[model samples]
Target chain A: MSAPPLLEVDHLVMNYVTEKGDVSAVEDVSFTLHQGEALGLVGESGCGKTSIAMSLLRLQAENAVFKSGEIRLNGENLLALPEDEMRRHRWKDIAMVFQGAMNAWNPVYRVGDQIREALDLHFRPRLSDAEATERISRLFEMVGLNPAMANRYPHEFSGGMRQRAVIAMALSCDPSIIIADEPTTALDVIVQDQILQELKKIQRELGMAIIYISHDIAVIAEVTDTIGIMYAGKLVELGPTVEVFARPKHPYAYLLLSSTPSVTGPRRKLAPLEGEPPNLLNPPTGCRFHPRCPFATERCSIEEPPMETIADGHRVACWNWREVPVSIAQEARP
Target chain B: MTEPLVKVDRLTKLFPVSRGMFRRPVDFIHAVDGVSFEIAPGESLGLVGESGCGKTTTGRLLVKLMEATSGQILMHDDGSMIDVAHIGSDDLRRFRRRVQMIFQDPYESMNPRRTVFDTVSEPLAVQNIGSLREREDRVAQMLQLVGLTPPNTFLFRYPHELSGGQRQRVAIARALVLDPSFVVADEPTSMLDVSIRISIMELMLELADAFDVSYLYITHDLAVARYMCDRIAVMYLGKIVELGDTEEVLSNPLHPYTRALLSAVPVPDPTYRKPPVEIKGGITKAINPPTECRFIERCPWATDVCHSTEHPPLEDKGGGHFVACHLVEKGAG
Candidate 1:
């Protein structure tokens, strides 16, 4: 058997305690990221894509509570670790590039100094200030930002440059895994493409695992090795990127792939999935996607679908996915 | 040829910059600089570019959200041609009924406290065109038109109670309640989910047909523009560098900027990836830019003439396709 995955999240369930009641955000979410591989978590907003990413880092807000789950990094159960220990593990073992990180940097300090501070905070006592500065310069170079611009304030850099600075800070400690949540959503097309390519190149050179999260299917397809489709806090479809796009098994995945207009491909009439996403507060019974899924049946509403392996490394949670013919809209392969 | 619904000529908007505590004049930010386009009756035109490229500013200008520094916005409705740029407040109010706008963010556009009925009927109320009961009837009809079935069910619901897609539908209903001849939608579906974007887009097209509305659709998404617009205008730093039939411009681009933008957009297919083009330097600052091609510094095919000369005029090539690049002008591309 292959070695254990660099990061493994098993049966994770997260809930947020509100004034009204406890709201289940992510339920029974499980996935693994191998060494030097990338996994993309994709879904519409409030679908628990961000919740799962936050669960991995233990960064959920005070209102959030993990009912049951095991977050393992390099075979060690991170969930079982103490808060102080988990804090130390963060950035050293895994780092995150947040959504809107372009504006996340401190405006008062130099961009380089902020990166250096991350390095010092994580790897202090062993790494001197001079050493941290050197690493910060190298990190900036890796992310395609000029080391000379490190002294410049956040306000001085463009949106793309600011994002690059954020990436540099994420890599300050040489973390084994990086979780990027919608890193390029706000960027222009050219800048977005450049950043995606840079991240891919950096991943190759460093041999680090990445969990890229985005709502844009095309953006996720471009960078991720494996794609995990989420809906209402459930992992609907988990499979290789090519297979998921080319031959989607789940109805939600198929609908998502077909609805989005492609920059390249023969234009077809997009048969949009009808109805809004189900309210997560009081989600639909059984399959969360059954409300909008065209192929849903009587059995689908009464009993929850089990995640079964249909092919090698491809898992789908649906009762009638087999009976449901892979529609022409989805098979418009390039 | 029939008169176009809207015509913009030499449209420009410069925002004054103040400096120091005394608030002395510093410089101007050319948000929309010498831009011009037109939408024929019942035609859809797309204005596409990167963020801060003045696509939104152009849309706002057409709707008279901000007065232009200089230009002519001539609205030809029925037979009368009214100059929108210089219209008085009273005339502006009358002009607003003919042209309306759908904002980008549905969350922020509609009032959180207002019910769906109130939100959709607000435009009719502002125009003072009907009684309260008549406005309610119109709002219900619009809700059904936008596919919010059993309009009574959603009539009293607040924005917070609806999903992103539902909120956008309500927003669209409000924009169309006035029965405007023209609508300017600024990235209307960018905030919605990918799975539901096409549904909203199709709904808009369907409504356009039913209402006989012309659209000035502004978005950064090329694929969406291709699907929605008959003609597309590629903007760069407040100037339209290319404008043509959507299929013609996309399949066979003339301008270098257009080509770069097309290549950079991420395609859904994983098997094919366009090799990244070397887009040197940063976005051209719109404030006091050099008197050259706005895309000169980053353009790979730029020559000395591109930098030292006046801004290239958008010259018509064959078949109504217009391009502003000198390379394209010389037939070198």
Candidate 2:
């Protein structure tokens, strides 16, 4: 617990500039990733979860601009580093398993060859042909894929297999951190479960830090050790996964958790959070969730709430966090 | 119990796969292989399965969007059952008045050029049930019923003008304008955002009661199915492996495939740990599928009995809980 964090994101703010206007995609977000820790960012669509992931890797789109704050890996600030210097850090220090990564491979190239390409680019002191083959095979095996299938093209593999290959490619560089964005969104439930278990197994074995970004809270709850809930562009809540799921402090977090339907447990009428997410281009002043929050007051619309710690490693950014129900089960009753 | 609203008997649909230089039909994909179920009046039935499992195809077949290769789709008419599977184009038009479909993607299902009024009133115009003025009133009423208040605002708007949730509401309005007795909604809210999805589902439930309509709601998410369906049918590789009351099927899954599927669903409780899924690999191509068990390739409990015999027949174990598995004995869990 005394070790310094592996990655520190200090008050990160990002925007997408367009002719229409600037979209405030990420607003004053701050978090840290310790070595071997698994954290999940859960939110609805367009809540800037992906924006944060892209910011971590400096892979934001051409129009994306970082307004302020820093992304520090170890003691070095990634934002201040030169483009060439940053390029060297990519994959070598931090790799990403992109959203909808099942189709990440080029159709024409063999799966093994595509993974080898990553090794050829980032893995220095160059591996010999035999050594590279051994490493690629090992990578495939590590991801629960048959190493023999690596010679097959992407088109030949199933959706689950392709996803495994994508994970293998991400780990080929042996990065200390892996940022997975909706890694299993397209696969079936069974396949998704298998892939998630495989990712957890790989993370545990390699002792690599992982940042999982997903819209599905259920998937996040199962895999992540810690959870961060994003609303509009802000991280509204950060806590241990069990603590957050058991007692969500932020109203947005509480409503989102209650709205999700579960296969197990008593079937309760899911209370849908009313209204759509706010437009980032002209988001509501003060609390971004104020417009849709049932507990919002005039003061809430005028003053933004700062993240406040209420328990060990549990923080909530809402003026009415105390008023928010302690548990979803109590609210479900009439 | 009241007479069922619709009964699907041994419904099957096969798409031929062509290969070789001459492009000959060498094989057939058994999309819906001898599937059967019933929808009660004012009841909702959920058909859930993984992609390419023919849940969508079954929905399309029920609404007569696609012709079935074989089987009977019987609908209760004024006094007797009518075989809708082979209804001629003339009778098909009349049958269409009683049944309507809501597609998965509201964004793509609606034509961009058509206004909301045009889309919702088309059914009334096609059925010739009301005059032009009456059709306009009916469309407005349907829009209000689907929770799109101030219907005048959305009446003339094109598809592109509405948000995703509003578009789906418009789609619902269009489907319900004719007051169809039965509806086949194929993954209606799957495309919407998570928060928006629940509202749409609740709206559908409210409309079902208001209109007194039955629905064959097809989806892959069991949680959504559990919410919307009174009874559930689990499909796999063109077969219904399990069918029962939604609570019964989910609480006590009998088939190995169903058990695996139920176990794989990630519950939202971080403290809850599901048993490990016992299946292996993903759904295989159904082209010229073997006559044996459809789930044999992945079922962990598959034995020689599963391979030697023909595909297991769906039989009620107890209290209308049906399963199609060789190992699951009668009267057993």
Candidate 3:
């Protein structure tokens, strides 16, 4: 636990400029991931979980403006890097497996050829066709896919196999950090389970850091070591997955957990949070969640709460963290 | 025993599949192959399966949205059995009011150009029910019933103006405007966020209780099915492999497919982790599949006889719990 972190993002703020106005997609978010660690960014849609992932690799859209922040990978500040330098760092230093990545491949091209193209484009002086093919084969095998199926088009592969191929392509450059954004969101339960297990296994084998982003709480809990709960472009809570899920310090975190129905354990009424997510265009004053939070008081509506460490590696940004009841006694902590 | 409101007896639907350069009809996909189930008045039956399992097709069949290849869909009304599958076009119009459908994607279901008032009132207009003022009153009542408060305010808003959850509620209002006896909902909450999805589900349950309506809820998620259904039917490759009480099917899954499905769902809790049941091979083509089990290719317990024989019949395992597996009947699986 004393080793230096592999990736550290501090006070990151990213805004999207539209004709209407400027929308703060990600605001003052901070987190760190150690080597071989898996951190999950869990939240609802428009919560800026995807914005945080995009900012890591500098993949935001044209209108996105980075007002302030520092993203460091292995002591190198990524934000300060030149465009060409950052482009070089992509895929080789930090690779991303995008959402619905199975369909991201060119339907007409062979899976093997597509992966080899990534290697030849990213690395200078280029790997030979034969060398790239060999590398792709090894990557495929590592992702629990047969190297023989490399010549087949994406249409021939099943949903799970196509996802595996996507993962294999991400690993083709041997990146130290992998950022997966909802890799299993569209898949069936069985296929999703297999893909998550394989991803965890590959992360362990390669000793690579992973930033897993997903909207599903259960899916995040399955593979993530640390879980960061985001709401309205802010990290509401960050802690070990077990501690955060079992005993959530933030009220938003607690409400989100209770809202999701569980497959295991006894059944109970889902405690749905009241009202819609706060509008990012005109977000509520003070705490972003104060409008929907049941425990919001006068202070909660006037002043934003800073992230405070309540326990080892557990941080929550709530003015009244102590007032957040431990009503979730049913789920035993790991 | 009282007569069930809706009963499906071996309902089947087939679509011809064409391939190769000839573009000839090579085979037919058994989209809904001999699916049979019953829903009593005010009871909710969940039909759950993965994509391409024909769960949505089954829902479409119930409302006669698509013509079934064969089999009986009987609707018991005032002590008379009306065969829904064989009904005429004139009678079908009347039958539509009794059986309504709620589609999955609210974004596509409603026209963006039309206001909420037009969308919800179309069904009444088609049925030629009441005057203009009466229809408006009815639509207002339905909107309020579905929890769209201050219905007048939302009646003029287009679908594009509403959030995902609001659009779904609008769809629900449209479906329930006719006050149907049986409703077929196909993944109505799947498109909404988790927090909003729960609220929509709760609202659905509340409306069902108030209206005394029976629901044929279709979804690919087991957790949502368990929360919404009284009984669950596990489908695979266009056939119901297992059916039983929601608790029984989830806690004590008899079929291997159901067991694998339960274990596959990532439970939110970290302490309770179950190793996923490994099923070899992917789902086979439903077109011209072997007469044997449709799940044979992916089933771990498949044997030589399983490949040669026809798919097993739904055998009652007591308490109305049924399973279709050759090995389970032989006490080996």
What fnat does each of the candidate structures reach? 0.78, 0.87, 0.68
TM-scores of chain B, in order: 0.96, 0.98, 0.95
Off by over 4 Å in 2: A330-334, B21-23
Stretches > 4 Å off in candidate 3: A123-130, A329-334, B20-24, B329-333
Could you list the CA RMSD of all candidates, in the order they appear?
A: 2.2, 1.3, 2.4
lDDT of 1 at A40: 95
Each candidate's DockQ: 0.77, 0.89, 0.75
lDDT scores of the candidates, listed in order: 0.88, 0.92, 0.89
My TM-score estimates for the predictions, one after another, are 0.96, 0.98, 0.97
Collision pairs in model 1: none
Model 1 error, position A12 (Å): 1.4
- Deviating ranges (above 4 Å) for candidate 1: A327-334, B21-26, B330-333
CA lDDT of B16 in candidate 2?
92
Candidate 1 residue-wise lDDT at B249? 87
lDDT of 2 by residue, B1-333 (tens): 489999999999999987877887979999999999999999999999999999999999999889999999999877778798768888888788889999999989999999999999888888887888988888888888887889999899999888899999998898888778999999999998899999999899989999999999999999999989999999998999999999999999999999999999999999997899998999998999999999988888889999899999999998899999999988964
Displacement of residue B324 (Cα, Å) in model 2 is 0.5
Error of 3 at B331 (Å): 9.9
